[model samples]
Target: MQPRKAATADVPELIRLRAVALESLGTNPGPADAPWRRIARHWFDERINRRDDCVCLVVGGGPGEPLLACGMAWITYHLPDSRRPDGRRGYLDGIVTDTPAHGRGHARRIVDELVGWLHGAGIHYIQLHTSEAGKPVYEAAGFVPGRYPGMDLITAPPGP
Candidate 1:
């Protein structure tokens, strides 16, 4: 049970773990050919690697081998009106856990480490959204459901 930061070279394994995460949600949107898969891979490669706020933790299968579990978090800090910038109320996003490692608390452990880091950095809040399957782990970690429902707005470019 090792927990460590994921490197850029780990992109392929991260993609595979993401496939497992999506399938666990039920419904195969088809193999990595799905548009969402491409988008996710791109996001992981471009966004996570470049952004200081993003972190991806991975667990290797053995001493030095294939990756088996992974978790990601994007830490955002909303600045207050007075502060110049960087003053933040941390928010964690895009978290995923590999399928075979699900019941072993790997996800919870990963999240625990992330939240600890945030708090240590003086972050006031650390929040993440979860699916029904992940609810138990979050709850066990003392996470309570948010009072208001969350929403998202999707946009698309003009079609050809």
Candidate 2:
């Protein structure tokens, strides 16, 4: 299981995989409009290429074939004014594994590889939100509960 940075050429496949991820989350990405596709492509371009404070990785693929898993890390550097030194913290995002490849540890492998990379990049404190199904895998990777309770702000579309 090799993990590597996704390339521009991996966009279409990444989009497909993302669709699968959305399905797992119980929603479709949206209508198949050019604008939507363009938006998605732009997101992929940034995420896969680590543009704009993000680092994306793909696994199980290489010069020979298809990547079985993909993950992303959105990093925010601690400002000089902030108390924390070291200059790097990250949020884990998009740990999606192909259903057919489930039980093979594809997702875990990708995440482990990403964590190693993050550590190498001088980022040690990281956080993530996961579905119940995903919780066990993350736990197995040594993640523990945070001191603060998690919260979210839900916003609805305007103009009913």
> Best TM-score goes to which candidate?
2
TM-score of each: 0.78, 0.82
Q: After superposition, how far is residue 148 of candidate 1 from its true place, in Å?
A: 2.7
lDDT of 1: 0.72
lDDT of 1 by residue, 57-116 (tens): 777755456776777666665656563256575666545666555677677787787777
TM-score of candidate 1 versus the correct structure, residues matched by position: 0.78
- Residue range 70-112, candidate 2, lDDT tens digits: 8887777777445448567878888988888788887887788
Location of the lowest summed lDDT over 10 successive residues in candidate 2? 79-88
Model 1 regions lying over 4 Å from their true place: 27-29, 33-39, 61-64, 77-87
Per model, how many backbone clashes are there? 0, 0
Q: Ten-residue segment with the worst summed lDDT in candidate 1? A: 77-86
